[model samples]
Target: MTFELLEKLENKINQAVETIALLQMEIEELKEDKANLAGKTEQLQSDNDRLNAEHQQWQERLSALVGKIEQAEENA
Candidate 1:
């Protein structure tokens, strides 16, 4: 092969290697982002569960208070 052709081939090979490296880095970054999102999702689910429990407790308290008020009204 001619010198010019060999030089061109080498340049193409170097470009391919650099592209591969960049793609690998991008893949790692995406993996990290996915893990972060999963953790955030878990935390949100936990928060939702806690809030639901608190809401149910408050509803029960409100219902009891209303019942007591109604009983008082009936006695009066």
Candidate 2:
């Protein structure tokens, strides 16, 4: 092969290697992002569950209070 052809091949090989390196870095970044999102999702679900439990407790208390008030009025 001519010197010029060999130089072109070497340049192409170098470009391919650089492209591979960039792609690998991007994959690592994406993996990290996925892990972070998963953790956030778990936290949000836990918060929702806690809030639901509190709401249910309040609802039960309010229902009991209303029953007592109604009974008192009926007796009066």
Candidate 3:
């Protein structure tokens, strides 16, 4: 092969190697981001469940208080 043709082939090979390296790095970053998102989703679900339980408890308490108040007014 001519010197000029060999030089062109080497440059093309170098470019291909650089592109592959960049793609590999991007894949690793995406995997890390996916894991972080999953953890956040699980934590949010747990918080929502706790809030729902607390709300149910408060409702029961309020109902009992209302019944007591009504009885006192009737007796008075």
Candidate 4:
């Protein structure tokens, strides 16, 4: 092969290698982001569950108070 042709091929190979390296770095970054998102999702789910329990408790307490109020009114 001509020296000029060989030089061109080498330059192309170098470019391809650089591109692959950059893509690998991006993949690593995306993986880290995915892990962070997963953790945040888990935390959000836990918070939602706790909030639901608290809401149910409040509902039960309010119902009990309403029942007492109704009974008092009837007695009066």
lDDT of each: 0.99, 0.99, 0.96, 1.00
TM-score of each: 0.84, 0.82, 0.72, 0.91
Clashes of each: 0, 0, 0, 0
Candidate 4 lDDT tens digits, 28-57:
999999999999999999999999999999
Give all candidate RMSDs, comma-separated. 1.6, 1.7, 2.3, 1.2
Higher TM-score: candidate 2 or 4?
Answer: 4
Residue pairs in clash, model 2 = none
lDDT of 2 by residue, 1-76 (tens): 6999999999999999999999999999999999999999999999999999999999999999999999999999
The residue-by-residue lDDT of candidate 3 on 1-76, one tens digit each, is 6999989999999999999999999999999999999999999999999999999999999999999999999999
After superposition, the stretches of candidate 2 with alpha carbons farther than 4 Å from their true spots are none
**How does residue 55 of candidate 4 score in lDDT?**
100
Predicted candidate 2, C-alpha RMSD: 1.7
Candidate 1: stretches off by over 4 Å: none
Residue 29 in model 3: lDDT: 97
How big is the positional error of residue 41 in model 2, measured in Å on the Cα after superposition?
0.9
